[model samples]
Target: MAHRIAVAGATGQVGREIIKTLAEREFPAADVSALASGRAVGGSISFGERNLSVGAVERHDWASTDLVFLAPGTTGPVTLARKAVAAGCVVIDVTGMSDPDAPVVVPEVNPGALAANPRIVASPVAGAILLSLVLHPLQALGGLVRIVATSLQPVSGAGKDAMDELFSQTRGVFVNDTATPEQFTKPIAFNLIPHVGGFGEGGLTDEEEAIAEDTSRLLGGVAVAATCVRVPVFIGQSLSVHASFDRPIDEAEAREAIRGAPGLTLLDRRDDGGYVTPLETVGEDPVFVSRLRVDPTGPNGIALWCAGDNLRKGGALNAVQIAEELARRGALRG
Candidate 1:
């Protein structure tokens, strides 16, 4: 049975990727509707040869759609999500709208969490998604007692505007001109920002807090300390994870566990150029892990670095996987 699909925020990076992924995966859909702001309406986007004219979400009819992929952006699906769910449509949110009441999910780490939720599911942010994928496998070995993570997130995680900011800033610098900060608080070209979100009470940015919260949520309550930073790169997100377990885990044991974990690609070597980087992870699906070693600081510690495509597994791809999970469980009755 073919289901009618809707991709909201269609003109944005994640939204465009969702539509591309749908076609690449050869998804069985009765039809796909691209919805966005008024500015993007009537502009056609190509999905595997089919030209789809963008529909202004405000004026478009949601009655014909059965499932909605809410892409990442400020225009969160809050108002629209309510309207869609009220109409009996399943919604997979790509944006980081915590929605305290809604279930936060990373299919590989917590598909079960999403199964019980009705109408809408919130996907974790790029840092959380990439971090959780690596941590979940370690859980089966013993149990994660403590997790300390540092993320090197690219501008792509901020959407198309941030990417443009980085590009324009870099070009301006080369020509002896400086691009003003428009989308970001600081100039992103040739610079790394330690802050990804606004500072809160404990000096923790919302992005940092979100990483800790989302990781714990997916790991079933394991404590996590996260530090998120924005790098100057255009794509890919990387993380340096320090995991402490109940029992001791040697380098061999840690490597074996991660190597066998599904949706994760292990590539650890010692000599120069042994680990993974954001540049190598672009357009890739699996979370690439490298720099595996035992942290001497903790009683039972394992430290490693991992990277993955933020636009794919981090955002659009995860949402698509959730949609697939919903179908497998008959959650999308429509």
Candidate 2:
């Protein structure tokens, strides 16, 4: 049965991508509503042949919606989600902390988590999903015990404004214009900032803490230590992950596991700059993995690199996949 769906934050990059993904995957949505702030209510967005008029959540009828895709800037979706759920709509939250009781899901990694809880599912940050998609595959080979990850994140994660900042700054720098640091704490063009989210205790940024927490939760409680950096790139996210397993693992065994996993594409090559990079992975679905080797610094350490589109796989695509998972199991209710 086709469900009636509402996509909140419909004007943002990830929200727009969610609509695109839903249409591309042929999700069984009998009607799709695009939702945004009140100012966007009369605005319109294209969804295939239909031009969906953006509706203000303040006035939208939650009772008529079957599923709600919550991709609003972190805080915007909280109230709408509660109301949507109360109105009997299952919600797939993209970047918010949904009801604490709601399962944060990566469908490929943990579909069963939602089998019983159909009302709400939260999508972890793209960084967490990217890391889990690549690292979780090795669970069968003695399982992951600990992970140390350094994420080279793109400006897109910060939002559309950050992306604009990067572009305008880069252009400003080239034409002998001053690249101002406005949206970011520092100029993002032609530079790398080793800070994302606010700083937390123990010298870890909030983004790092989140990656650790979400990775552990998604990967069945494996400890994660993350250092998140904001790079100048416009799209895609890359992680250099050093994983320690409970048992000995060699390059061949690790490569085999990474290459064969779902939602991951092995792109490791030995020579001539053969490896996955953010530029090559933006707009792609599968997490492109490369640079697999046994870490020489420590025992039982397996190191690898991974990249995926921050907008798609990291945000919209993951959200869409969660919806698809719920629909496949007939968990979506109007």
Candidate 3:
């Protein structure tokens, strides 16, 4: 039987990607609805050959929906997810608003966690998504002890408004026009912003905290430290991850392990600089890992660079993948 699906925040970047991915994957959807805030109402979005008119989410009856993909910014997703699930819809939330009670899932890492709650599945953050794919192979070989990562995040990580700001600022700089900074506190045209989100206690930005916590949760490991930064890039998110394990690790063995892992592409070529970059992986679905160097700092430490499309693997694609898995398993409303 085909499932009836509704996409919340359907006009946003991640939301649109979810719709595109659903169509690309040919999910069994008998009915599909696109929902957005009042401001985006009347706007039209194309889904394959059909054009879906944007409807106000507040005015929709979500109870009839079988599954709802909530891709709104941080604030809206959680509330809408709760409502959708309470109305008998399975909710897949791409936003980072996770409850301690809910499973923070990276499907490649833990598909079993989805079985615990039929109501909601919380997608991990971009950094967590990249790290989980990289660490999965390592974790299979040996237990992971610690991980240190630094993210070179793009403007799109902040949201669509941030991307707009960067584009306008870059154009202004090119034409010698005065540009104003609004989406970000600092100019993002020619410069990088060390800060990504609001700062919390102990001087960690919210993005960093989310990355660190979600990485640990997704990997099922307690020891992980992450330092996230927002760079000048536009689409992809890159991470330099250094992981320490309990046993000895060989480089060739590590490469073999990564090659066998699902949803990961190993681009490690030790001969004269053959590594993956953010530009190379901007639109790619799989996590790209290269520059695999055996860390001399610890007994079984390995350092690798990882990159993936933040909009796809990090947010939208992951959510759609989870939905597909659920559908395949007859977990979505039947």
Candidate 4:
């Protein structure tokens, strides 16, 4: 029997992509309900060949749903996910909110952890998800002691409105039209914003904080430092990661480890432009890594560049994958 799926934040970027990926994967969802906030009610989203109308999630009966995917939104996904779990549905959340009581999972990294959890799975952020895939093989080889990462994130990482704001601002400046910044603190067109989220006391943005915390939790280590920056790109995110390992790792061994990892593809032939750019990685599923080199300063240090579709493997696709896992484990009630 096919499961009944309900998607919260259905009108958002990741939510819409979740619906598309689910359909594209031919997931067995006998009843797929598109749910959003009250403001987005009555709207419609295209799910494959069928357009699903958005309904207010507050009015829906989640108890009858077999699975729920909560997209990133202002509404607390953790709270909603817990409610869905209490209602006996498997909850897969794209938001970075991790409950100490629940499991924060990246399927490729820690799919085993899900079996012990109740019913909710917290998806890591785009940067963390991509980083985990990049680091998985390295971690398996010798284990990572510390990592310094800098993310070049796109405006779409902020949300759909941020993408629109960048487009509108770019056109306004080019056409001499009045430009009003709504989604971002400053103009995003032809410029870079060092800040991606709210700043803390020490000047780290929330996005950066999330990367550090989420990476630690997902990797089962608390030794990663991250600096996140918003770039002019509309989609995809790139990361420059410098990792210190617990033991010596040769270049060939590192390459083989990364190449052999699941959900990751190594393009690290550094002879003649062997790398994956954000544009090349957009809409792609796996985390693409390139420019692998040994850090000369440390005996066990390596630096690499990685990229992936922030909306797909970073958010929506990961959520769908978790749902598939739950279904396979018989966690989803039909």
Candidate 5:
């Protein structure tokens, strides 16, 4: 049941990770095409033990491709996605440019949503994925009421250039050189920016809005308030989450729930350095949960710290997992 697959935006950070994840997981792909813009067409990207010569995505023939992973930075991704769908190829959109009504899926949380064999499925933002993974298990203990989260996102979430800016700025600071902000609005080295995306109505950034919207959708009908911040770190994302449920659930009960949940690891030890950090979660799949405590402010509230590799579980790995879900459901076309 090998299927033909194409990964658009094959050169970007998340795009490359998608290809790598497909290979690492040994997806049943009869053909895998690496595609990017014209500038990256001739470049070579590794796929398993082979190197794939990149192709221009705009000129690719999608009629024969059974599936496409639409990563960010693909020029006219919205148009490209429609074209792919028209060609009868299922599209897994990671670009956030899909139809507003498209099903946003995190396989670990709401995989049943894929039973319909949808033409287009959106991979939720990394922050939302992280938030949802941790909160979903607890929802089974009691219905979720409200969620308050502040995310410390790494620069890699922005793109490769943002990572470069962080590195160069840190180097410049030690060499007595001024580090001007390029990928960011402010110097990211030794500093933090409370801004992650464009400010929208009521002063909430687009990132915050997306996280709240996606989390609520994923968790059924819970209220979510998010404040996304750009930190000086490199790879993983961290969150301080406070969640209230309909029933009073103790920290021990919540810990047991997280431990048994798939795609989640409970690492609470109540001692310094006993829990996972952003740096330690790099290149990992499961979301790491730590600092679990019962929030005293509310009757049925719990507080915790969570970290994960945004590129993997948050983006590429999640998209690849959706493709896997499709395969398992016999939804993918040959």
Candidate 6:
């Protein structure tokens, strides 16, 4: 059965990708509505061959909508999520501001976390999604004992304005025109920012804390220490992960595990240019893993590098996949 779906924040970066992903995957939608804040209500967006007129979220009829993809930057997403759930619509929140009670789901890692007839589900941060997808496959190689990862996130993860900031700042550099920091604390052109989020308890940035918390949650309570850095890249997110396991595991076994895992692509080679990079991963779905090797420093330790389109699997794609899982289970209201 085709469902009536609404994508909130449809004009923003992640939102636009969510809209595009739905159409690209040909979701079973009887009617698809593009919704945004009041200021963006008059604008338009495309869904496959059709151009959708953006509607105000306040004006959208929630009761009639069968499903809602609550994109990041959505207006009053928490309240809207509650309203949609109350209206019997299944909601997948990519905004990270959904109900704290809602389960944070990554379909490739933990589709079973969704309850039968779940009303709302939250997707983890992009770094967490990227980390989880790569690490989940390795869990079979004995239980994951400890994880230490450093995520090099792109500006796009911060939103459209940040992406613009990177572009304008870079162009300014070429023309000898210095730009002020607005979206970020410092210039992002040809520079890296170690501070991705506000400083918080234990002196860890919010982004780092979130990556650690979400990765642990998704991977069944394994200890995770994450350091998130904002890089000068545009589209993809990359991570350097060193994980320790409970038992001995070889590089070949780990490589084979990743190769067979769904939603993951292994691209490891010993040559200089044999690893996956953020540039090549743009617009791609799979989480590309490379530079896999056994860590000699510790028992049963393995290390690797992974990258992927953050806007896709990290946000929109993960939410869509959860919707697909719901559809597969016939848990949707439509």
lDDT of residue 235 for candidate 4: 89
State TM-scores per candidate.
0.96, 0.97, 0.96, 0.95, 0.99, 0.98
lDDT of 6 at 67: 96
Sorted on TM-score, best first, the list reads 5, 6, 2, 1, 3, 4
lDDT of 5 by residue, 112-224 (tens): 99989999999999999999999999999999999999999999989999999999999999899998898999999999999999999799999999999999889997999
Give lDDT per model, in order: 0.86, 0.86, 0.85, 0.85, 0.94, 0.91
Task: Find the number of clashing residue pairs for candidate 5.
Answer: 0
Q: Clash pairs of candidate 4? A: none
Error of 6 at 304 (Å): 0.5
The pairs that clash in candidate 6 are: none
In order, how many clashes per candidate? Answer: 0, 0, 0, 0, 0, 0
Candidate 2 per-residue lDDT, tens place, 1-334, comes to 9999989889888888898888888888899999888566789888877788888877889999999988856335677788988999999988656676678789889889988956879889888999998887788887788999999999988888899999998888878998778888898998989999988778989889888888888988888889989998999899998999888898898889887888999988988788988999877899998888988788788998999999998999999999888888888874
Please provide, for model 3 over 93-144, each residue's C-alpha lDDT reduced to its tens digit, 9 standing for 90 to 100.
7776734556788888888887865688888888899998889888888899
The candidate scoring highest on TM-score is 5
Q: Decide which is better by lDDT, 4 or 6.
A: 6
- lDDT tens digits by residue: candidate 6, 55-145: 9899889999999999988999889998998888999988878787788889889988885667888889999998889989899878999
On lDDT, the leading prediction is 5
RMSD list, candidates in order: 1.4, 1.3, 1.6, 1.7, 0.7, 1.0
Ten residues in sequence with the least summed lDDT for candidate 2? 72-81
Give the local distance difference test score of model 6: 0.91
Question: Candidate 1 lDDT, tens digit per residue, 1-334?
Answer: 6778999898888899899888888777889998888578889888888989998888757888899888975255788888888888988877766256678888878888865756888888888898889978888887889999999989987878899899999999989996688878888899888989889999999999988998888888889888888999999999999999999888887788888887899988888998889999888989999998989997999898999999999988888888888887887755
